[model samples]
Target: MIKAIVNVSLKAGVLDSQGKAVHHALDSLHFSGVSNVRVGKQIILELDTEDKTTAMADVTKMCEELLANTVIEDYEIELV
Candidate 1:
């Protein structure tokens, strides 16, 4: 079996309203020295195949097609 860890984040120059909200909340809570905040998502997939190469390809395809919005989000895939 193989495990694929996918991280999806908004691309640079894209506005992250959720991240901004979190940052504001932190500030309100007296959390100082907080600059920019970015929010992302992680997806863990377990595959039945043992081949690392195939798992990587399949996971990449899944991220590009359904798991992420390629137009504004970037994804990183890790295979284990």
Candidate 2:
């Protein structure tokens, strides 16, 4: 079996409203030293295959097809 870890994040130059909101909340809570809070998602998948190359290709296809919005978001896949 193989495990695929996918990280999804907004592309650069895209506005991150959720991150901004969290930043504001942190500032309100007196966390002033923090900056550029970007929010992202991690998806962990356990595949039935044992080959690392196959697992990577399958996960990359999944990300390109459904898991990530390629127009505005970027994804990184790690096989374990």
Candidate 3:
């Protein structure tokens, strides 16, 4: 079996509203030293296949196709 770890995040040039909201909330709470904040999504999948290369490819495809929107986001995959 193989495990796939996927990270999805907004593109570098894109605006992250969620992160900005959290930053504002932090400031309202009197939390100092808070600079930039970014939000991301993580997904973990357990695969029945044992082949590392194939599993990685499949997971990457999944991320590209459904897990993330390439137009506004970038995704990374790690096989474990």
Could you give me the TM-score of model 2 versus the true structure?
A: 0.97
Give, for candidate 3, the lowest lDDT window spanning 10 residues. Answer: 56-65
Top-lDDT candidate index: 1
- Give TM per candidate: 0.97, 0.97, 0.94
lDDT of 1 by residue, 1-80 (tens): 99899999999999999999999999999999998999999999999999998888899889979999999999999988
- Those runs of model 3 whose alpha carbons end farther than 4 Å from true positions after fitting are none
| 1-80: candidate 3 lDDT, tens digit per residue | 99999999999989999999999999999998999999999999999999999999899889878999999999989988
lDDT of 2 by residue, 32-77 (tens): 8996899989999999999998899899999999999999999999
- Candidate 1 residue runs with Cα over 4 Å from true position: none
Candidate 2: which stretches are off by over 4 Å?
none
Error of 2 at 7 (Å): 0.2
Provide the global lDDT of candidate 2 against the true structure.
0.94
